[model samples]
Target: MSQFSRLFWIEWKKLFADKTIRKVVFLVPIIYLTLFGFLYSEEKVTNIPTVVVDADQSELSRELYRGFDADETFGLIGTVPTEEEALRWIDEGEASIALMIPAGLEQNIKAGRGAEVLTVIDGSNMMISNTAVRAANTVVKTISAGATLKKLEAQGSWGDEGMALYTGIDFRYRVLYNPTFSYLSFMVFGLAGTVLQQVLFLGIALSVAQEKEQGTWQTSVATNSFFAITASKLLPYLLAGTLNMFIGFTLLLKGFGVPYAGSTVDLMVVATAFNLAVLCVGYMISYFFKDQLQSTQIAMMIAVPSFMLSGFTWPFLSMPTAVAAIGKSLPLTYFLDGVREILTKGHGLSAVGHDLLVLAFMSVVSLFVAYLIYTFQKRKTAGTQAESTIG
Candidate 1:
């Protein structure tokens, strides 16, 4: 066997022998996948509570109130005589939206004048605000159209002319990809990629520390080529990362009925290249640091910034130009975009060619730097040993 191969085997064996490393490699990914997967599922956010204050005391107004209650999007939690009571419910967090119909609503509608129904919304929760606003608007439009048609019929003017005027234009809305706008479909894919990155980084960081802690790094560096040593350390992590990706995508994503329209082979290719880059980064970090605790602290610090700048949680287009430019410099940013395009948009290799090339180039560059650092550290250790022998 080659000197590097034997050294690599020794390092690999040492890594396997550590119980903490073994537990971390298995547990971290599973925990992340389970936690994020369930949190982003479609079962969340089914109904929002709302209070209604009906002062009109008219059949038409009562029908409108019933319409809001009947809709599945909202649950009519309470009926109040005064607007003050409804506001109290909102302040207490018992309701997300409050509907107030003034006393003269039916009187104005009967006189052929438009009546206003005031919708009071709590803006404290952004998701609740958006959902309440949309549901309230839909209820208002439907009720108004129905009331108008009824009034026209009572006046003996509900003819084809009235119908034509009432239905001025058909507004068709098309929701692409996820027609139902299921949150699970959108979030699961993102969570899967994120979990993969975290596990891969943590695994590599710990792997390097194992060598340092066991005092094997000095011996391995003296006997093996830096490239060979780095590769040997990286190989197991690459396997672990790839396996984690497959398990997350299959169990969490596909099992939840999220679409997997992308080319599997292409995703694997990109993921493999990305994992190698991450492994090299881990080795480079190890060369600079000596212990597992320091490595973990540095890894976590690096991960938080890398994840934030990756454009997964936040859109790159919405950020300031300078901030966006800096985010684009991160490798995770490109990898995330490529993963999203391939998995969500079903984009081909040609579309993600630029990102793939960038990842490949980064991997090569990082590996070379790690090799050089390892070589330097090795020479330093050897010179110290020679001096000690002379003494």
Candidate 2:
């Protein structure tokens, strides 16, 4: 064979010889396509969680409540006594939108004084926010037209004459958190979080794994306590990732003009917890897979799908059960959700208390597991060395 042809033939043989390469070349794309296909199979967001605050208990108000409840776009969980309670439902993630009917709505309509209805949409994810807004508009317009026609008939106006005289009710909708629906505001922060995850995961996935691959893992951790070994491996990556996050967000705020309504202290606390969770998970992967390339590929596999599964672009509540379960297991999901809440809603750590706790818990659990793996491997190595020495 010619020199170039001989080299090509050898390289082609080597490619199929590696199972990881074969999987990446053929199977990864299929898996990713299947995941995303199933994810968007519903095509559009539906059955958005909604709450109603019907301050007016009259039949007209009930009619309006029924209108919202009956709509397929909205799934009204329950009625709240006040708008404050409805807002609480939104904050706690019980609902994505709130419809408020003020007192005397029916009386005001009958008197021709005009009634006003308010819609409040949680705007952290603009996709869901926009869907909710459009659906809310449809429901209000339908109800208003019906009410207007009824009033016009009472006054002896009908058909085109009544339609000409008809004027719809005043419907005001407020998009909380991100009112403008700036794509940058909605998307960039989450993308940055995903980047941070990939960088940390790849960087640390080689930490102990590289030593093990080089036949030095035992010597490196053998003399050091497990705590010291784990801390030493994680501390550098943690600092680097935290600095990366701070600078990245600073640019997003100053350069992109993405608004931050939340407190800096709350942001720092959540960021720290998120960093710890990611680093610990990466450390665990390094301990689990001693091959540097295998560990790196595994990290990439996780980080690549994390952004799509994080529910940054789509609402988590709308995802399929299996997809959402996988998403909930990842640190990026909680971190991105918390970041959006802080940036758009001006919420404190107390408000996103659940997300904060989950990230913290993940960090603790992953770190403990990594330590256990390291200790087990260490004892195995020592036993092997003792046997060889006695022999």
Best by lDDT: 2
Candidate 1 lDDT tens digits, 1-391: 9999999999888778976575567755675565344434433333568788889889867887788878776778878999889877765546767888878887787776656777776543334555666777787778877777776777788568586745211122222234445567666666666667777777888888888999998888888887687768888888888887777767865677776558878888788877787777766777777888778866765564565456565444334555557667666777776776676556688868888888888788777788788768888989999999999
| lDDT of the candidates, in the order given | 0.70, 0.85
* True-vs-predicted CA distance for residue 153, candidate 1, Å: 27
**Given candidate 1, what's the lDDT at residue 232?**
85
TM-score per candidate, chains pooled: 0.57, 0.91
Which TM-score value belongs to model 2? 0.91
Candidate 1: regions farther than 4 A off: 1-171
- Badly placed stretches (over 4 Å) of model 2 are 1-10, 111-113, 150-159, 162-167
